[model samples]
Target: MTSIAKQIERSYSATRASAKASRLVAYGIQPASRMVDALDTHSVHWRQWQMDVVETPLLEHFPEGQRDALVYLSADSDTTITQLEPGKIYIVGAIVDRNRHKGLCQRIATEHGIPTAKLPIGEHLHMLSRKVLTTNHGDGWR
Candidate 1:
């Protein structure tokens, strides 16, 4: 079966480990940034993984094939998906770290031989903030 791979592996930063832990907690409680709570309103079934997804990779877990449909999404990807398709798993990178673990998601997908697509962010007006949208914003589009 084809599935979506969200290459959301965040390399641990030992020097900033304490700060990251606290940052994660802040992300959970803050409604504007809380992804799970927002998704609950839409009834989207999802799970929150405590560990790096790379350890228990989804590509290894699920059956694979082009016929089944396994695609991943990332800002680093060149391909774009304007509309989501049925029977396709849309893996959203779940890294809460703001450092833009740059290309980490795309790298993982490439390692798994999973295709990738990025949101059409260029058509919109140029904003002052960084281009990449929050996970909440991406999920809301669906």
Candidate 2:
């Protein structure tokens, strides 16, 4: 998952982050203000997105009791996603850290009691490179 952390956000240049957010929006993904302030800053074509600016963090945006429905996708997670189940709000982090902060997302998810899962890439294909994927690539948008 590429969810934003101050460190991760700082790791990216503002323009690159904005461009990534734009791509997510292009793929119909709703971005949070904490990750990218494109809507508030009016830095991009805000009208092209089909979502309202989410001012709060995801955990607060949803009802407390619905926390179980939130799933954080982290490459470090032990669990692998075999299928896309309905009624689950899957969170894909938006940062590109280059592995400097390995297991950060999974740690965050564990601390918040949110379940975490890695993609089933290993089950389908073998690769010579690290398993980490870019936010857009992981989401099947690139």
Candidate 3:
């Protein structure tokens, strides 16, 4: 059986895979806003993986260099569900292992009719990228 965190991770990965084949875009919401800065300088193995695009930090618009996948990591305090667009997919993973505020984001998605996957625990950076590449894109902006 998969661990709770692994289960969440798998669910996200499966979602991303489905989206990639269908030409959909997906974003991974980071647990905290600080990840955004780290992602910009972080190394993503896009070339080695042969993926059209690799994970990325938040930007005004999705980068053209990396097509297909756009990973948007959100800060933990990002409570703006209104930013989501229709027909988009998003995987929200908390940066910390704590579950104190877990499911809050998923609940928000349900309330707005936005489809989302929730990771019970924080996942590694690479795992987060893999999840983003494979999930479907929702109608929302990161």
Candidate 4:
């Protein structure tokens, strides 16, 4: 993942933690400034600078496995349905067989006593990024 993607992921995790703790930490990637005039900008933007000096280095210290463990690969319903595994992270991508209600991939994981976190891809794209590649193009172009 690119630095931006990693930052976005970590930002989401941090905000989620802050929310659960009932504290308004306001930690995340700040939106780009919209002001047109560069000279009009007042006050030094210390967050990015401070982050580069302090926070960026801390990210490198986290174990590789921990980072990978935090990543959840979202896939289409059919893809998820077949690839359900214990101790693995995943998110719902697209619903393949809505009529059969096969989209509930979490149920399969639960039955096996595996911890699974399911995020609705359409609604929670920011939180869960889909990375699964498929041979079948949804629109039948293939």
Which candidate gets the maximum lDDT versus the true structure? 2
lDDT of 1 by residue, 26-70 (tens): 122223333434544432332353333233336555545642576
| True-structure lDDT of candidate 1 | 0.50
Model 4 agreement with the true structure over 1-142: per-residue lDDT tens digits:
1322333334334434452321211222224422212212432342332122222221243334354432233343222333345544333222232336443544543443433443334442343334333222122222
Model 2 weakest lDDT span, ten residues long = 20-29
Residue 104 in model 2: lDDT: 83
**TM-score per candidate:** 0.50, 0.62, 0.27, 0.21
Two-way TM-score contest, 3 vs 4, winner: 3
lDDT of 2 at 9: 28
Rank by TM-score, descending? 2, 1, 3, 4
lDDT of 3 by residue, 11-105 (tens): 43454555343232223424444433343334232123222332443232344443234223333333434344444544444333235644454
Local accuracy of candidate 2 as per-residue lDDT tens digits, 9-128: 232223244534421212223566333554334334444444344545666676557787778888888898898777677776654535687778888888878899988876665766
User: Scored by CA lDDT, what does every candidate get?
Assistant: 0.50, 0.58, 0.36, 0.33
Model 4 ranges with Cα > 4 A deviation: 1-97, 120-142
Q: What local lDDT does model 4 show for residue 15?
A: 38
TM-score of 1: 0.50
lDDT of 2: 0.58
Order of candidate numbers by lDDT, starting with the best: 2, 1, 3, 4
> lDDT of model 1 at residue 92?
58
